[model samples]
Target: MLSLYRAGYSPWHRLAAGPKALLLIVIVLGVSLLPVSWPGPAVAAAIAVGCYAVPGIGLRELRRQLVAVRWAIGVTAAGQLVFLGPGPAAANTTRVGAALVISALLALTTPVGALLDALERGLKPLDHLGVDRQRVALLLIVTITMLPVLARLAHDVREAQRARGAPPGLRHFAMPFLVVALKHADALGDALTARGVR
Candidate 1:
């Protein structure tokens, strides 16, 4: 479930994580701040296409990442349709989809450990403000690691219910997935405690 990173000797892989992450953040913020119907989506689309051209990544990975955010895109589009209009809705959806692709590209190229270490180092300067950089980094790492696991768990639960002749419904899977997630969280906490992380 945590197999987003693709190890390779490509230029993207050779780049340092700190600069890559900083650039991504800056770009995301810059695009997000633009007018909804401006050229933001067009520029983002171009960059996303460039991301897809990176070695070790293909259409399959791109499809998987886009599919993962389909629901969000649909909901956002629907909301904007009702409140704003079709043009703005389309532009906003495009922008959001482009952001998702860019983020997926980052995850696909960068190792999780490197990202976490970069985050910790980035946060070190804020130590005087009562922030625990290590703890924050750990939390971010855990959150990122759990995302795909949770998605897989939900998918498995749905499949299991379907195989058992139950209707394909989230209601049937919600409680079970919650229990499983809680158990996983407890195990994670115990493991961290044993490792003297706190």
Candidate 2:
């Protein structure tokens, strides 16, 4: 789903991924530091929405992505409203929500491979410091790819366990998940080695 979203032919899709990721970080930090004002968050949300207006980007698909993160937005909003007082506290919550939505839009429109390449290029200077830039880049790529895969695997495992009458508990889930994850990691490592990535 994520890859599909990133595969569009929008202008944002044409932009280099590395710069887009940096822009995302900057936007988040800038919005967070700005005083709790309605305009800033509103503008951020508008920009995120406008990004969807770029040609070849389906609004429905963007809506789906927003829906997927609805729970997170709800949690943040609820926590802020419950823990903090009202007024500016609630505004902060909205600001965070806007930032998350904007970030998602950026990711949705940017290709992962391009982004990874950009990251690798940006971190090139670290190689002089003996940081093993390629290894770090590979690790980052693996980590990013594994996140969604792991989520799907966990969901499937939970459903399968429930079907087999196993109790839904961490004790029953953790070991199997870890074992499966390790197997995947080993397989990925083998593939990487075969491709002379290390």
Candidate that would win on TM-score: 1
Candidate 2 local distance difference test against the native? 0.69
The pairs that clash in candidate 2 are none
lDDT per residue for candidate 1 within 1-198, as digits (tens), equals 244687877667788999988777777776676677668667777766776776767667777777777777898899989998989888888888777666666676888878888999989898999998988987887776566556656666777777898876668778988987788778878877986787
Compute the lDDT for candidate 1: 0.75
| lDDT (10s digit) by residue, model 2, range 36-90 | 6667666656655665667887667657556555666777877777877676666
CA lDDT of each prediction against the hidden true structure: 0.75, 0.69
Model 1 bad stretches (over 4 Å): 1-3, 144-149, 159-166
Best lDDT among the predictions, by candidate number = 1
* Per-prediction CA RMSD (Å): 2.8, 4.4
Clashing pairs for model 1 are none
TM-score of structure candidate 2: 0.68
TM-score of 1: 0.81
